[model samples]
Target: MSKLCLVTGANGHLGNTLVRALLAEGYRVRAGVRDTSDTEPFAGLDCQRVYVELLDEAALDRALDGVEVLFQVAAAFRHWSADPEADIITPNVQGTRLVLQAAARAGVERVVYVSSVAAVGHDGSALDETSWNEEVENPYYRSKILSERVAWEAAQALGLWMVSVLPSAMVGPNASRLTDTMGFLESIRQRQVPLAPDFHFNFVDVRDVAQGLIRAAQSGRAGQRYILANERSSSFADLLRAINAVSPGYRQPARAPRWLLMCVAWLQEAQAGLGGRPARLTRSQVRLFQGVRQEYDTGKARRELGFQPRPSDAVLREAFAYLWRRADQ
Candidate 1:
């Protein structure tokens, strides 16, 4: 009999991709989702479905029963929220702790935690596994940082074997829905962005990141973090060029001054505070990425897990093409 694997948040973009990858590897998969009605992502995929409420200890314990590997891929992923502590922090930090504790009790052999580059610091230098983002004002980033810390603490106390995989700006095709990264590219393609901020971003294929997670489960050292990202970073202008190359006729937004962009973000936040729609651009986001390049070294994952990501341009082009096709449909 093959080893059983339980993937939380199997409905998410990365989670679904990881499910497919695990299935390809001939592992018995148990998909943990909040809403069983959201079944499109699992269509035609042979896997057991379980309701997973990370905050609920009983549900997690039931889901983790007989699972050899537990992939903790669920988290509150958002840049801005009305109540940060309630909406983001508690679920992530508390949920991670509960999940790990349940896994330990269920006798799960290994765990692969899905962390984000948001938890990793970028100080205009090439970041590696050792870099930590301690000065985070963004609620979502702080949640990830705290949650990963909690996961590590639980693993140490419970003597659970755990590895964390940090992925940067994931993009690719076959996403069940328009993810935030894909939505950003769609905004660019649809000319929804009137002005582009001077920011550099790292892109990685979602499939590659899924593969990296599987590799980490197979070969990564316990108590280690692996970065699943492109080695080089791409400027905002470079992203515009890639979008144009993939789909013509959409004009790129003019580069805006940092001060002007900051003011706009402030107004957007104010509007959101007034009980309006959530702000598309937040002051925290502007402060985080303005004129900053997000780059990382994947050598650790490469050397240890044999991880190799596709080129950023290729990933971007394919992502935009998928967006264009979705728009046309």
Candidate 2:
């Protein structure tokens, strides 16, 4: 019998990549997704598709049965929810607990949890896997940090080997939807953001992130976390500049003071509240990004998993070309 692996959120960008990688590695894969109608990405590959609703304990428990390794990748990702505690936190925290318990009951050997850089809050220093971010006031960040903690605590109780992989802002082609980096680039293309945040962030190629996750499963220490980020720390303006170098015709957005941006965010959020949808701008973003500069050292991942993330310029160039081609089509 082949080694069995379960990858939740199999339809997502990273999940999709990991599924293919696992199949190539000769592991029998169980793809846990909400929809099976569109397996276009997995065409010609034979695998099992299981419907996974994160909040549904019975469904997740059944999905975990007979799996040797479980990759928990499904999480609620948003800055705001109609009810933050109920919608975001509850589902993520509860879902992780359920998966940890189910995996233990099913006698899974190891669980690899896909965490986010949001869980590691910003300090002015070089971030490593040990850095814990305290910006829990932001609902999305709070949910991720709390959910990771929930997974770790459950892993401790269940005596399961667990490794967490944290990915920075991701850049790649063929996005199924507008993710954070894509949305930011879209804003630049549309010239919607007349003012940009004068902050810096580390980014990684989605391909590298996917590869790192697999390496974590193979080589990461039990109960250890790895930052799957490259040395791509730069400001928003710099990122746009790189895109403009490839795409051209993009004017750099002016930098606005954090206070002024907060006021504008409040106004936009208020208008969005009246319109009964989440706002594009919010106060939480201000707390998270405004005037903040963060970078990470991936020495642990490099030494342990032989993780080698690519440079940002090459990744951003391919991303811009892909987006431009889509625009032309």
lDDT of each: 0.89, 0.81
Q: Write the per-residue lDDT of candidate 1 for residues 265-291, one digit (tens) a residue.
A: 999899998976778888888888888
Candidate 1 regions with alpha-carbon error over 4 angstroms: none
Per-residue C-alpha lDDT of model 2 across residues 1-329, encoded as one tens digit per residue:
77899999887767877887788888899999888787765677678999888777788888988999888887777777667899888888888888888889889998899988888867656688888877778888888899999989999999999999998887775466656666766666667888878768776778788788888888889999998886547787777877787777877667789999899889878887788687777888887777777678789989998999888776666667667776786
Off by over 4 Å in 2: none
Could you give me the TM-score of model 2 versus the true structure? 0.94
Clash tally for model 2: 1
Clashing pairs in 2: 121-133
TM-score of candidate 1 against the unseen true structure: 0.97
Best by lDDT: 1
Please give the distance, in angstroms, between residue 1's alpha carbon in candidate 1 and its true position after superposition.
Answer: 1.7
Q: How many pairs collide in each candidate, listed in order?
A: 0, 1
